[model samples]
Target: MYPTLRVRVSRIEQLAAGIKSFTLQPCDGGALPAFDSGSHIVVHMDQGRMRNAYSLTSALDDRSRYQISVRLEEASRGGSRFMHEQLRENDELDIGAPANLFGLGDGAGKHVLVAGGIGITPFMTHIQALARQQASFELHYCFRNRDSAAYLDELPSTLAPDQLHLYESDTGGKLDIDALVASQPAGAHIYVCGPQALNDAVVAAARAAGWAAGRVHFEQFRNEVDATGGAFEVALRKSGVTLQVGADEPLLRAIEKAGVKIDCMCREGICGTCETAIIEGEADHRDQYLSDAEKAAQKTMMVCVSRCKGKRLVLDL
Candidate 1:
């Protein structure tokens, strides 16, 4: 794990009805760390060790401050609630160094950005970079309505009128993923950060239209939970312990509950810190960090999200 940096909140501004942008500066009064176009900082929330990842929205070259936006989500895992209600402008917090898994590719000449709701935060940096390089790019933002759109007030001033497109579902405006994918130039690359449904739709459409997998980029944030999680038996070969993991419990939690501690950073499986060798059984890989070749090999699995393809599985743990 990288060393944590202590930062102080410099300012807070409400961007929308329930969305607010926070500006953070180094508490020690030093320059903040440099970041890439689409980097994210992990915020350690409250005292519960709840780590929440927020994309950096401020300019990449600027070290004066780092900005991150948060939407109040009462139904969420309390991270958003802490940011909206408990966090104050002068509050000090510990944050992780910049990490990028969804950064822009320099080789891609034309860029197409598709954002849903708060997903536009990461693309703010990308937009500035594209403008500086005088590259061809377009942004399509999909929101529930005007009130739910967080960055509308600033986007118009920052982006050209022809480059930005807003689609409001409440007003019968449609994003039309199929049509959007069909309309893109053959070599143009697409960057997506949004809800699972929106991401899945874009990926599916791109693949169906014969777009290469390398040309499609996405930011993976949360743990994947479909209806497929079922009770499975895990065999810890090194410890000679067998544990039953329930549908509601993550594999890491089950292992920890059995008095086994595995070194992990991001439990969402995007960090690849909890990856373990698969002694036996087919792994139902669900992590965004692993490549298709690695998943097909079935030599390792991220214990945090992956499950056993069959009833029982053995781990080197």
Candidate 2:
């Protein structure tokens, strides 16, 4: 289990027109735990009623403070809006320890980073690490416009001019996925984080360009929407309880409503914090955290958003 710490915002800065970065300091005035590039924290808010995930935008060597950038999402579930508009310096927030599914390769020859919009948060740390080590890398950033791009002024100075590529859709220029994939050197490791469309484009382009599967890595920044809300019954064998999940309700909410406890971070199905074992039944896994083999096995499910295919599911809750 991850340790939860209460942190206070010591400073806040507007990175872009709609983006704000908050520097958090430990309330106990102690050194924060060490974290690597691409690590993230789960923030508890609304009196623990909601938990949201945010990528760390600060350097790993800076243990005294950690920073996270937030973009005002219009259709947000109150977390981003509260962080951007309501939260003030000196306010306290419950934060989880750093957890990372994205990290630099241990022995990769070349690093190719592709970022879009707010996805640049994790790439910031990667770029800092690469710069310090003088690693061979390139960063391709895609945004809707320059005004909405975070750390625009700070990034260019950190990365080499030739290694950085920026694209703005509103400016009639988009990320040239074909050119990027074609330009990648042999045995190059590709890392991409962005919207679903951008991710799909990169994956498709890379595959079409004959890039190996193991050479490509991606992290999604959006939730998996459930279009076919199928009703199902979940049986918690360990607890000797069962619950009926409505078509619109998620398995996590239904189980929690029955007094069962399950830890979750990003309820959008991106984080794997709420993963549980399935003893029986076919799980319609919708999360992006699981590997292709894991999804094919159907032994585990992300209760936050995944559902059962049949009428009943036996879970080892």
Candidate 3:
């Protein structure tokens, strides 16, 4: 288990129709751990049964409190719903320390950010920090409409004129990803955070435009993985145990039920914390953390979201 911080909900404000901003302060009234602009913290809800990561939207310099915005997910697995419905101001919760899987390019000549809907949260702090350093950047934010755009009004104030661009689907504003990728100057880095479809499109566009894989950074807000696959068997080499993984159950959950402990943060497979070695068998990799090359190698797999390709897998557990 990751270290947790006891925090009190200082404030909660409706940012949009289904989005709310939460202000969390240290319960002991001390400075919270510092984090980078694009960092996120996992909030443990439902007595730690449900964990969800929310991007930090607050200023990076402020250690007194951390602000995160949660969009009430329509198909929520209880995390977003709990934050919106059950959680209230003055409520106390345990949240993991900040972990950054997304951050600004160290020395890129220009930074291009593409955000879709609630995906604009991380860029909120990114743009602020960039503006403070007088960095060259552009934020292209897209949403269904003004009513659904979280912190739309506040973004313009943070970015300079022409640095912020808006695209509303209701207004027939479509972002031409290929054109956007082609328009970027040399040495520019592209960062995207949005739905899986949007993230895939950006990656395809970048690759087609001859951008190096490292130059294109993307973060998926959520992945709709079908966990109900064919059942398989996992052999724990070190423990000398073999466990049956149910068709409807994830591999990681099965390991835990068998009394095998695995340190995992995001069970969604994006964090790579539950990644374990694969001594034998090919993996039906479903995680976004592993690269195509790594998946093809099949030396290891993220058990949280991946499964064995064959009926049995030998793992160096």
Candidate 4:
């Protein structure tokens, strides 16, 4: 577990009608840990009542300050609204060290980036890195409208206008995943981060285009669930105890209810803090943090939101 650092908002800019860019600086002028383009920080808010994850929108090389864009989610569970409406300059907030599961590799022949709505946060860092290296890359950004698009003005001037393609869904023409995937050159690497619908479309199209799994990388904003989802019994291997998880209750909650303390940063499964080893039985991996191979091996599981596929799972607490 990483120690929480104190951060204060130094600057705030209204990027769009409901979106704002918050520039944060450490309370003490110490250099923060170096982070990659796709890394994110987990903000500890309201005395740990909420832990929200925000991607690093600033360049990795520039460590003096960090930036994150917050969009007002009316139906939000409360984090985004707090940041967007309640936060003010000089207000202190607790932030975790950077954690990343999405990053670019140097060996990729070419890069194709796809961003939807606020998903552009991480890609901003990717573009900065690629630009510094003068790598061949293209970005396809899809949004509902220009007014709702965060950092719209800064993107065109940052990258070649021709390499940046903007698609406004309200205009009637959707982002043709088939055309986008087909347009990529041979041996190109595809990176996508977006909502569930956009991600599904892109992955489906990429697979249909004969792109190998190794050549495609993606980060999902939400956890994917299995169709036959139901609660099961979980046995703590170390303690030799069992708990019956309720239908709507997550495994993490069930474990906590049984008096086992586990450290968890993001309950939504984006952060790997709650990961614990699974000694036996099949796990229905629902998290976006781990890779397919990691889940297949059943070495570790995010008990916060993930459940078991078998009738009973043995967990290494």
Candidate 5:
């Protein structure tokens, strides 16, 4: 597991209709850990019942505090609801150190960013870093309307008029993924963080246009993992214990219930912190962190979201 930081919520502001930004300062009034442009921290809440990743939206050089914006999810599993309703200023919380699953590429002549709804969080810091470096970039932001767009007022003042583009779907504004991909200059890299449908569309368009896989990057804002599966037995080789995982329970929860301590972040499967070695039995791999070839090998599984495909499975533990 990543090392955690004891932080205090110094301030909170409503950024949009359902979005709120939190300013977290070190509990001891010291500097927080430094993070890159596209890094996120896992917030451990509800005595560890919920662990959700929130991107750092503050400037890269600002160590005094970290900012994260959360949207009240309609179908939340208690994470967003707690942040919105229960959490208050001056409250203390534990959060994992910065982890970068989505990073700005090494070298690109130009960069294009596509964001949808709350997916714009990572780009908030990315824009700051890019501007300081005088890098070439363009932002294409899509949202339902102006009122729902988080940071709508700040974005225009932050970026050049020609660099930022907004698409309001409620007013007949639509982003043409294929056209956007086709319009980018050579050696340009595109980064997208948004809904599954938007992600799929951008990836498909890039592939159809013969763009290299390395040039396109994306991070999902939703938990698409269907944790529900048939009941199975997991045997821990080292502990000499076995636990019955319910059809609706995740494997990581079962391990914790059995008093086994495991390191995990981003329970949604985007982070690979919970990956465990497999001694036997195939797994129904559902995580996006592992590649297709890795899933075929069945050597390891992300216990947070992935489950056993067979009746009984053995883990190295």
Candidate 6:
């Protein structure tokens, strides 16, 4: 369970051309919730529960503040625009308690970290943790140009030469995904956070290099599911209710209309917050969070992006 707290934006700085970073602190001047590395808080921005989950970029030891970077995307759904334009310093806003889907690998002494664009947010925690522990680690950040990449100046100054590498496409610097994975030791763990293409490429390269499944970690920040998907009927077993979900409406929204509230962190289905047991129907799973084995099992489905394969479906809700 996550508690909602009101926090004031202490500072807001433009990190890049399109990105703005905000520093938030508790309104009451009390200690904020303690969080592990790679945690995020859900910011509910509207009456319809329009929320955006942002990675906490501040260090874990910094209990006085929490930082989040927002990119003003051209195709944003108003969340980024709201933060970039309407939100200001000294304004109080509601944010959820920190929750981590990506935790540091303590058992592995050697770590390889990869980031693309804003995916660098969560890795700040990982880098700090590894540096504090004096563990062996390397980070590769891929971006189109320096102006577009957030934390461009900050990371290089903080990290040593052997710790960080920046690959700027504008400078003709390319990342050899295949070679990078092959160079890592067998005991090393590889973690990546990026767009679909980058994430897929890294995972594929690592697997081809014989990296075990357990040794590879990733957190996809984008949800590429098509919103104009076909809809169907859903049956709630415990509630004894059935609702008709329109083709244009997401399954999660349909369920919410029927008075079933499922706590959702990232509505994009990447966080696995809305996974529900499938009582007796096939689901067209469109989420990136589920593993191959989980998808093959067909026991659960992520309602945020997934839909029914047939006319009717039963859920353990």
C-alpha TM-scores of all predictions: 0.81, 0.86, 0.88, 0.81, 0.91, 0.88
Residue 309 displacement (Å), model 2: 6.9
User: Which candidate number maximizes TM-score?
Assistant: 5
lDDT of 3 by residue, 6-113 (tens): 999999999999999999999998999999888899887878756678899998899999999999988875778899999989999999899888888877889999
Choose 4 or 6, whichever is better by lDDT. Answer: 6
lDDT by residue (tens digit), candidate 2, 165-241: 99989989777789888887787888899888888899998889888888888878753245137898889999999
Q: Give Cα distance to truth, residue 164, candidate 4, Å.
A: 0.6
Clashing pairs in 2: none
Q: Which pairs of residues have clashing backbones in candidate 1?
A: none
The regions of model 6 sitting more than 4 angstroms off are 223-233, 244-249, 253-265, 280-284, 291-299, 308-312
- Where in model 1 is the C-alpha error above 4 Å? 223-266, 271-273, 280-299, 305-317
Estimate the Cα RMSD of every predicted model relative to the unseen true structure.
4.3, 3.3, 2.8, 4.5, 2.4, 2.7
Compute the lDDT for candidate 6: 0.84
Q: Model 2, which residues run further than 4 Å from truth?
A: 223-233, 241-250, 253-267, 271-274, 279-285, 289-299, 307-313
TM-score of 5: 0.91
lDDT of each structure?
0.84, 0.85, 0.87, 0.81, 0.89, 0.84
Model 6 poorest 10 in a row by lDDT:
222-231
TM-score of decoy 4 = 0.81
Candidate 1 C-alpha lDDT tens digits along 1-317 = 34689999989989998989999999988999899888888887785345677889998889989999988764665678788888998999989888787778767868999999888889999998889999999999999999978888889998999899999999998898999889888689999988878998999999999999999998755722331388899999999999998876667768877888786656677778889999989988988779999999999999977888888999998
Which 10 successive residues of model 5 have the least lDDT summed? 219-228
Candidate 6 local lDDT, residue 219 = 85
Report the lDDT of model 1 for residue 257. Answer: 72
What lDDT is obtained when candidate 4 is compared to the true structure? 0.81
